[model samples]
Target: MGIKLDEEKGLTLLEVLLSIVLLVIILTSFASFFTQSAMFVKKNEDKLSTTQTAQQIVNQIEVSLSKNDVKTSSVCGTLPCLLEKKELSNLLGSPITSSFNISAKFADSVEGLIRVKVSVTDIKNPENSSETFTYIRR
Candidate 1:
């Protein structure tokens, strides 16, 4: 007997199932790509945030050095001379104080010249950190 008109016009069960399987395969392949891309974006954002935070700390250090009354001695000689963490935090103020563990150090880059280094560790991810450096006088 000839096939019914409705049956002939519609997709068979096997055809429908194959289409679904193909869709799932395509979607799964693309899913991994999206996930990896998201992770990459997040990592870069974190890195940029770290660098910006470090830069802010460096700017503060520079400002402190530029002051006429700023006191620094020629010690440590390129080795980092640690600054008090609380003092650094107080200098940074509210915007950055809560988000990072800040460490600062200065060394004698040359006679009467100092090299300032500011390092910031992300509070949420301690292993993630950035350091910024600058040279200042006295």
Candidate 2:
């Protein structure tokens, strides 16, 4: 009798199929996670961009308010209209929107204090909009 070995070292068909199914499940979950993460990042970025733009708008308005230049116009207009689209675009280094819509609504105005509601909307997507209220003093 020559050398006889009792060893079976190959995976069965069932074992191979089960392992493959497990790997597929794991990989699919990871892929969905990565996809969700990417979406979150994009949405966050858009929000940030809109917020920054809104901040800049508020700052400019505050400055004008100090100089006694803010108007009660509902829509932004040229030169003396309180706000202008081209002017805002010029102030931003990289504008997220080619154009924007600036609208103002007065919440309350009294002596030494004015409550103004302003909305900055991206022309590309209205959902990418920001609103802030600023108080101005006499």
Candidate 3:
């Protein structure tokens, strides 16, 4: 009698193991990609928050200068005045991140202009910070 093929033959153990290994490798790569994407998004959000905070501080300074709310004599006895942190905090309430720095200086230069500089820093991530400045007439 001639040799006959077995119709009931199925996949061997080696074939099943190979498919499982390949699937695991693909899934692991995807997982790492997702993790990296999440980190990037978080960093971007922090940068945006810092930028908005700096802009807000700048706006507040501009408004105060325009309305003459800051009195040179009362706040600073001389030129190149540094605003008290407490006063600025009271004006801005609570910022997105409490860790920030704002500096507004009034110097008697030839132009009689006030320099307002606002900076916001994320204490946790120093790279996430922003600074904005503007000049206004005294």
Candidate lDDT values, in order: 0.70, 0.62, 0.66
Q: Which parts of model 2 are misplaced by more than 4 Å?
A: 1-6, 71-99, 105-108
Candidate 3 lDDT by residue in tens digits, 25-117: 999999999999999999898889888877777776665554243443455545566664565554435333356654455545446565666
Model 3 stretches with alpha carbons more than 4 Å out: 1-10, 67-73, 89-111
Tens-place lDDT digits, model 2, residues 70-110: 33333422222333455433332223343567654433355
- Model 1 error, position 105 (Å): 0.7
Q: Global lDDT for candidate 1?
A: 0.70
Which of the two, 2 or 3, has more TM-score?
3
Of candidate 2, the 10-residue stretch with the lowest lDDT total is 72-81
Candidate that beats the other on lDDT, 1 or 2, i.e. the better one: 1
Return whichever of 1 and 3 wins on lDDT: 1
RMSD of each: 4.2, 5.6, 3.8
Model 3 earns a TM-score of: 0.70
Each model's TM-score, in the order given? 0.76, 0.64, 0.70
